[model samples]
Target chain A: MIQLTDIQRDFQVGDQQVHALRDINLQVAAGEYISIMGPSGSGKSTLLNMIGLLDQPTAGHYQLDGQDVTTLSDEQQARTRREKIGFVFQFFHLVPRLTAAQNIALPLVLAGMSEKERNKKVTQALTQMGIADRAEHRPDQLSGGQRQRVAIARATVIGPAVLLADEPTGNLDSASGIEVVKILEQLNTNGLTLLVVTHDEALGKRARRRIHMKDGLIEHDTLQNHPSLANP
Target chain B: MKTRDATRFAFDALRGYRTRTLLMLLAMSIGVASVLVLTSLGEAARRYVTGEFASLGTNLIIVLPGKSETTGGGSPNLLGGTTRDLTLNDALAVSRSSLINHMAPLIIGSAPVSVRNLQRDVMVVGTTSSLLDVRQWHLGKGQFLPETDIDRASFVTVLGSTLKQELFGAKNALGEWVRIGDRRFRVVGIMAAQGRSFDIDVENVAFVPVASAQMLFNTQSLFRILLDTRSRESIPRAIEHIRRTLRERHQGEEDVTIITQDAVLATFDKILRALTLTVAGIAAISLAVAGILIMNVMLVAVSQRTTEIGLLKALGAPRRQIIRLIMTEAALLSSMGAGLGLLVGQIGSNLIGYFYPALPLGAPWWAFVAAIGVALGTGLLFSLLPARRAAQLDPVQALARR
Candidate 1:
């Protein structure tokens, strides 16, 4: 569950203040599938980043899982982010030097998990992502789809409560994009909360609940009539 | 992160740029090696000078005819500053102490000597038979001058080996009469070849009886009186007894200056030691330069790895962990450099020792320790700014830099 009450974010550029987010209020229950769609500079990505705990609101209150996360210290924010949230960037920011398995094992390693448990978790993540054979390969050695899969594995390896995907299939071909969208939908059907921000209309229409934004404000938030394809 | 993981991460970064890593290592090692080599050379020079002084003579003391001008902390002024005359009788009084082994009354002058056909200017040292013991010079042939009395003039002369060869040309110089300073004297002995020492060449000098020397040089004052004490412990006692006896003999006037060989050696030792430390300090500057180079290289490395740092932060690494990782890399770099430097410096010192075995050129263990310590310290200290920069980078801004 997530709640943002009157969250505002500002950036100062050359003696001018630019408001990136303003007067935003939102609430989401557990196990929700949401898509945020907008043109560039509409602050859709900014909203997703706020929910992901990467950027702090200049003036607002944010509560996640009953804790007021906006008041948390930087360290506490990092801990909360580590424990309950996962982020998938459009760039698939895999450490170029680490193999796929090592990349997936990074969060666990940062958590000081023992080597045996880390290996077990990483192996399981590799198998679940269907890229167990690519575990030994570096990011440069993998295809676009495989790299995205590794990034997804890295994100979900901590078993976080919410998965935030910023243009998850933006760089992939249609076939691979469909494959990734299906995988995200499958995870959502199994009760993982998913919030995706995208410019792809096809991918945006796939979500049952869609939110449209423009000029640092949410233009629309609505639920369309659709039964769960995953359950069907 | 665990220490082992930190180390591995550091090694990975270093391994990514092998050429840059090698260059940094080279710079650090060269700095440390120079410190070690220069300090060793300083120490070797000190020991060499000390050793040279040790070989001059053993437990010997000199009685000069003048008071020492120093305020008790300078070298013994031997040949100058005398206010009163010291005669052979004064030498006799100092030789009568129980701790005195023997005394050689010395009157040095230089004049021309000639045989029937050969002529050369030669240094003339006037001493008694005790010269053989006091100077530690051995006769190459025949006998030295005999001791009858300080005032007795025996027209017998002793020739050094070179002087003998100059006058007699391989013929026997003993019992040969040579004209020296307008007086004809018989050569009683030939000295061995002794190269320059104490500004006197025993091989180029001729010896004669003390009274003969006084008559020839036309002076009554003795130049110096060389005394060998009975034991090392008795030197202080001998000095006290000579001062007392000479003061009594000279009507209670302490005109003669007495100096033990230890004092002259100690003065040189102190001066050379100070010189050595100054040179070592000059060498230590290179280490600081190396430290600056480390800072420069580390600054570049941080910029190059900005994205990686941002990623690590995103993965939940703390700011302190980022700093630790950079510092760990610096420490590893410097430690390896220090190890290589130790090897190079010891090899350089051994080469110097091999070329000139007289200098015991062992770099003091402290020099080795200091070089290594300074190398590691500078490495860590220099990387602080770069590490801070890496830690302060905003994860979003850093990643956006591409």
Candidate 2:
């Protein structure tokens, strides 16, 4: 579970001030699937970065599992990010020199997991993501879909409670993107809170909760009432 | 990261840029080679000069005349002045002291000597029987002139080893008649060869009685007075006594200059040491240039690998680890250069010795250590700017780079 209240972010560009986010308030319970849809420059990525603890808001109160994460130092923020949040980037930012298994092992390694434990978790994650055979391939050697699957495996290898995907399918084709979206939906079904930031309407409709943004403000927040997927 | 991991990372980076690493290594190799070869030349020259001076015989003193005023008030050449007329009486006065072991009043000139049809220029030295002891000369074939020969103004002459070789070829030179400046003199002995000194070979000279030389050269003035002390420890005191006695003999003029073998050797050492240091100093400039080259290469590498640095940082590598990675790359380049330089310098030293046997070409073990230290220090010093730049880069900005 996570909560953000009265979050504000500002940037100084030469002599002018730019407001990136203003009076943002949001909350998400555990195991929810949410989609944030916005046009370019609508502050969706910035808000996602704040939620992922990758950037700090100028003024805000952030509660993660009832602890004030806003006042934590940079190192402590990184520790919390490593322990509770997994990030999936649109470009599949896997280290070029490392194989898929090594990339998947990174988050666990950062969490100070022993080598044997890291290897075991990486194997399970690779198998779960259906990329076990591609584990020995580097990012450059894999297809776009396979690379994104590896990145997702790397993100969730440490078993974080929340997955924040920023346009995870933006670089993939329709078929590969559909496969990635299905994988993310399956993880959400397995009790991981999933928040995806994207501009695609079709992808936005797939989430249980959808939020649309315009001009740095949330335009709508909608929850689908269909029970067929809930039982499926 | 641990030290082992950092070292492994550095080695991998170096392997990735093998050509650039080799270029930097070549630069440092040239720097070290210049230092080794130039300093070795200076060492050889010093040794050669010292050996030549020592060959002049130890504990000996030579007194030369002081400068005089020329017609236009310019200073006269001290050595070119007329002989100071030191006599056998002065020589006897110095010899009477317990410190004096042997003494000789020398008169020297050059003439052409001939035997049969062979003729060559030869130096003629005139002195008492004590000249043999003072000059450390020994007879190789016949007897030296006796004390009785000096009083008799003996026409008997001693041929130098080279002089005999020149005048008689392989024939026996003893008891043979040689024509010295139109006067026939019988060679009574042949002195053993004493190699070259001050460009003149002592083995190419002939020795005769001082009274006979006075009659032959038509001069009563002595060229110099040579003396040997009874013991090396007593030579300094004996020199002072001789200086005092000579000043009195010369009417308190103090016009004579006394030079000892030790003083000459000391001056030679000082000059050589300065030359060696000067050469080594000049070579250090090349080393500095090599350091600059290393810095330039490291900066280029940092720029080229910005994304790599960003990736490492994102992977939880600390700032210090990044710095160690870059610095280790630099050290690896320079140390390889130093190793190659040592090999090149050793081969060069031996090549030079093959051409000149008198010159010993060698590098002490400390030279190798110092060269390696200089290389490593240069690498660390030059790597600072680039390593710091790499460490301070923002991960977002770096990752955004292509």
Candidate 3:
């Protein structure tokens, strides 16, 4: 679960001031699947970045599991991000020098897990993602869909409570994009909260909740009851 | 992150750019090599000067005609303008002072000497038979001029070892008649070889009685007075006595220079040390330039590896780790260079000694340690800029870059 109160982010571009996020307030409970839809400069990525702890807000507070993360030190923030949140980017951001297994093992490595435990966990995650055969291959050697799958495996390898994806399938083909969405949907089905920031209406509509943003503000936050969640 | 893990990562990164690392190493190696070579040259020169001084007689003093202006002016030279023409009287006075063991008035000149139609320029040293005893000049064949020869002005000469070899080959030159500047003199003995002194071949000289030399050369003045003390500890008192005696004889004028073996050797050592320092200083500049080259190369590397730095930071690597990683690369380059330089320097020093036996190149362990210290310090100093740059990069901005 995450909470945001009156979040505002400002950027200085040369002489002019730009409002990236303005007076934004939002919350999500456990196992919630939320999609943030907006045009360019609508603060979707900015909000996602804030929730991911990759950037800080110029004003207001963010509470992650009841702790005020906005006032945390850089190191503390990084530790929180490392332990509780995982990011899946549109660019796949897998270290080019590391193999899929190493990429997937990164979160655990940051947490100071033993090599043996890391290897075991990475193996299990690879098998779980159906990418076990390609575990030893580097990102450049893998296809776009395979790279995205590897990215997902890396994101969820640490068993974080929340997954934040920013245009995760933006660079993939439709079929690959659908495959990545299905994988994300499956992770969501397993009780992991998923937040996807996207411009694709059809993809955004599939989430149980859709927050449409514009001009640095959240214009709408709509929740749809999912048949799967209802049954579970 | 742990230091071991950081070192491993650094090593891997360096391995990734092997050629670049090698180039940086080569630059630093050149610096270390320059320092080693120049410093070794200095060390050799100092040893050579010290050895040369040792070869000259210790506890012995030479009283020259004119005092050096640097030591302050006193009595003017009697022979020429500045050289003293100390007589046998001055020598006798110093000898009777109880501080002296042996003393002699010496006159030095060069003339063409011929033996059996073979002629060569020979240094002619004129002194009493006591000169031979004071200098430890032993006779290999026949006998030197006796005390009676100085009283009688005997036309007898003692041939140096090389002179005998040159004129007589393997044959006997002793007791043979040799012509010196048109005067025929009998070679009564051949002096044993004394090797090189002050770069001159000491064996190429001829010795004759001082009385005969004065008559032959038409000079009544003496060029120098040589004195030997009974013991090394008595040299300073003997020198003080001679200085006081000379000052009294020359009316309190310090014109005549009293140069002891120790003073001459000390002066030689000072000159050699200064020369070594100057050469070493110049070479140190090249080393500094080499350090600069390392810094420049490391700066470029830091810039090129910016993305890598960002990736590491994003992976939860602390700023100190990034700094350590960059510094390790620099230290690795410098230390390797220093090792190679030590090898190169040792070989260079040995080669110098091999070619010139007079110049001894002794590279002590401290020199090697100094080389390493210099290299490591240079590495740390030069790496500061790049390390700071790497540490100061924004992780988010860095991660954003392709």
Candidate 4:
């Protein structure tokens, strides 16, 4: 489970303080599928960044899977991010210099796994994402849908419990976007806690729980179909 | 991250900027190679001078006519203007010391030599027959100067190979009569061609008796006294004894300077080593320039790769890992440059050795170690600023930095 209590984030733009997030309180159960919908400047990205440990909240307590992680050291937070949370982006964020397979193997490499084990896991991830045939291709050589598939493979290769995606299909055509959404949903069905921050109403409604944000505050929180929360 | 994976990632970055990588490597290698080559030349010069000194015979000491160290200094002593002249007796007296090995009193001048109307001006060295033993110079034909009393004025002479060739070409030089200056002398011996020494052509001079040379030059003063000590360890004692003996002979005045071959050689060794290091330092300045180039290029690279660094952060790489990544790239470039520089340096040394086999032109081991160490050190040290900036970038700002 992920919990945020009274989270506040401020940015100093020029001489005045700008609130990027304010009094945000939320809970995400394990294996839950949630979407955050808001217009530009709604602080949805900042919230996702905070949950992924990419940014720090100005004030608040954050607990991921029941452990307060708000005050973790940088290295400790990096380790927590590596082991428990993964991120996907609208750009796919593939390293252009690496092949599709090497991209997926990066997290395993960071974790210092044995070559034999990393190779096995990377191969499995490639096959699972249906990009086995494209494993040796660099990102520029792949289509938008294929690139996102590679990114998905890379994000989940370490088997993180929670996956946070921001504008995951913002750059893709509708046809490719649908394929990416289906892949993300399948991973959620397999018991990964999935959080999607987006502007698409159709994709937002597909999530079991949805939160609406405006001007750095949450406007609504509703559950369409609650997810199973008791998987070991 | 595994060190191997980090290294591979750094190499990929380097490969991405192929032109910049090549330029840095070129600059670094040139710096290292210049240091190696210049130091090798300096070392070889020192060695060559040392070898020449060794060839002058072992444990040798030279006695010159003037005191080189002028205590009550007026104007500097004019070259060749001595307060007093060393005589033949002074050399003979110095020879009497049991610690003295051998003595050869020398008188040197140049005059014309003629045989059957063939004439050329040739340098003449006046010394006793002990000169052959003192100098360890071999006779090519016939016996050397006859052993006679120091004042006996023997009219016989020995011809060097070049003088013999000039004055008695295709004739039996040992039996020929040559007119030196206004005197007629019989050539009793001819010397082998020994190379030049102390700027004088050893094979282009005639050898004659000391008294005869005094008669020929109209001077009773000996030019210089050359002698050896009984053993290497007895050199200092020999010099002290000779100095005391000479001071007494000159009426309590130290009118001459004694030069030990070892001391002169050591001084030259020190001077040459200092020169080598100075030039090596100048070459090291080029390494500093290359290091600055690395810093400039890397700073630019950090901003250009902001997104990638942000991605690395998102993928759970710590700040230390990011620093390591940049440093590894710098290290790889420097180490490679050092390697290539050494190869070029060794090749340069080999080329010098090939063209001048007697030069002894090979870089010392310290040159190798120091060059590599400084290049790598400069590379890593200069990369710190860029590495810090890369590590300190905010992940969100970096990701959004297009």
True lDDT of residue A216, candidate 4: 98
lDDT of 4 by residue, B1-402 (tens): 899988998998898889988988898898888889988988898888888878788788999998888775563454334578899889888989999888999999998888878898988888998887777788899999887788889889998888788777777887778899999999999988887765457778888899999999999998899999879999989999999999898888788989988988899889989988988889888878888888888888898889999988898988888899999989898888888889888898899899999898988888888889989999999999999999999999877654
Candidate 1 backbone collisions, by pair: none
Per-residue CA lDDT of model 1 for B169-248, tens digit only, reads 87888898999898999998898776555546878888999999999999999999889887889999899998999888
DockQ of each: 0.44, 0.21, 0.31, 0.65
lDDT (tens digit, per residue) of candidate 3 on B1-402: 445555655666677678887887776676667667777778787887777666656767888887665533433343334444677677777788777877777878888889777998988888877776566556777887767733357789988898889998998776789988768899988877777666335689887888778877878778888888888999989989998887787666666778888888888888877876676667667666767777888898888877667655554555666787789888877888788777777787778779987677775455566677878888889888999899888755665666
TM, every model: 0.85, 0.76, 0.83, 0.92
Tell me the spans in candidate 3 whose CA falls farther than 4 Å from its real position. Answer: A94-162, A170-193, A198-207, A227-232, B69-84, B96-105, B116-118, B127-154, B158-172, B188-195, B245-255, B364-369
Q: Which stretches of candidate 1 lie over 4 Å from their true place?
A: A175-192, A224-232, B70-82, B102-216
Top candidate, metric lDDT: 4
Model 4, span A136-209: residue lDDT tens: 99999999999999988989999999999998888899999988988999999999999999999878878889
Interface RMSD of 3: 2.6
Top-down DockQ ranking: 4, 1, 3, 2
lDDT of 4 at B253: 77
Docking class of predicted structure 2: incorrect
Estimate the TM-score for candidate 2: 0.76
- Which of the predicted structures, 2 or 4, would earn the higher DockQ when compared with the native? 4
